[model samples]
Target: MKNEIIPYILANYPDLQTTKELLIHCHKLGIKYVELGIPFSDPSADGPVIQNAATKACINFNFDNLLAILLDLKKQNINLEITIMTYANPLYIYGISNFYTNFSSANVKGLLVPDIPFEERKVLTRKNHSIKNVWMISDNLPSASLKKIVSNSNFYLYLVAYLGTTGKNIQQSDSLKSTIAQVKKIKDIPVAIGFGIKDKNDVTNILNIADGAIIGTSLIIELDKSLNSAKEFLNNIIL
Candidate 1:
């Protein structure tokens, strides 16, 4: 009940300064958790809205400087649970040896690398206990695979709601309700459903079945309209 929705935001959207302001605004609005998407060359997992945002963000995606921004917010006491979502290549290129150290210095709370699967996650998570490792799953993972991922997650697990990339307006599938319930039965972490929840009603229904909704593309599209429109959009769905 406590975790209602987790908004997935593109870092450096519109540009870096506005993105920082939007993050602070969301925290003030009582949104506790945020996923800061690090733009990669191939954001094939996402749709056009997010892909375009990634293209824009890639211009200014300086890893250390971005962490510095987070560090700056920490000094200002504007604390929001921040997670870096990216592919494995970026982290490896960032130097796995120093990746956790840098992320820790910035007070990053979690990692949601979509390309890494559960069995292989320990290689990263084992190095850093400070950041929570979030596992991703869809409705159709093998039962053994699902249980293994769900078992290791005591913090959060990402449940991909449908089969498509992000930004598509796919409705919740008939199988998702049971999938979420089964995961809840097997593990205790909050399950955040994502990838195609497009409206307030969709959010409400996601909350009804899962602990949280990991909303990304719609929020990106809304913020493009105006920061205020984005705020209003949150107002429409968050209560």
Candidate 2:
């Protein structure tokens, strides 16, 4: 799979048409891989930026809205490597088998579940080997656990730069550099860095150590501010 700089975006926008338009914006920005966040009532792993977006999305458009967006993406032949970032509760409530089956048919290529324990990964991997469920690891994770976790992951390993929730913060410090260096030595699946990546400098900075960077909170905030002009908003960053 193409492990490029995959920037995340909220899937639960106010309208599906605008969401599609934002996707076109991303494609124009030359970003091939896109992580679309699936909003739930209670997103434990998400920070305030995403939490607010989810709240708005839930009020304006709920689970049915997400399914409709998926269906629309299918019908429009949007053809992008789309990964759904969601918590386990929604999947369990929707029935894992059904979620996989539906998401597979909708052409979703991967999954990201933050709260699922490492020991229970098999619960997801075994459910459907075809679904590329990416696992999360943080800077504090032990080397042994990380090695095992990354080894077991088929898609990608999400490396959290810090322990805090996602939002604006300084770039990953020297300790993060050491951590990335250690992770680089492992050489399992592609290691993608996320959490607290705020600007273009972050893009160039993270590229030095990891295969890709996942920017979520920054993108969400920008998307919110540019609700009326997503293309212009994205161009200001990507260009």
lDDT of 1 by residue, 1-239 (tens): 35567888888787778778878887778888888888876887888889988887887677887888898888988888887898888787887657677776676778888888887875575553477788889988988899988888766888898877897875766788888878888976788888998888888888878888888889888999998888788777775
TM-score for candidate 2, residues paired by index: 0.87
lDDT of 2 by residue, 3-108 (tens): 4667787775656676777776677678777788877667787788888878777666555566666677678876677788888877777777777777776667
Q: Rate the local accuracy (lDDT) of all candidates.
A: 0.81, 0.73
Best by lDDT: 1
Candidate 2 C-alpha RMSD relative to the actual structure: 2.4
TM-score of each: 0.93, 0.87
Query: Which stretch of 10 consecutive residues in model 1 shows the poorest summed lDDT?
Result: 121-130
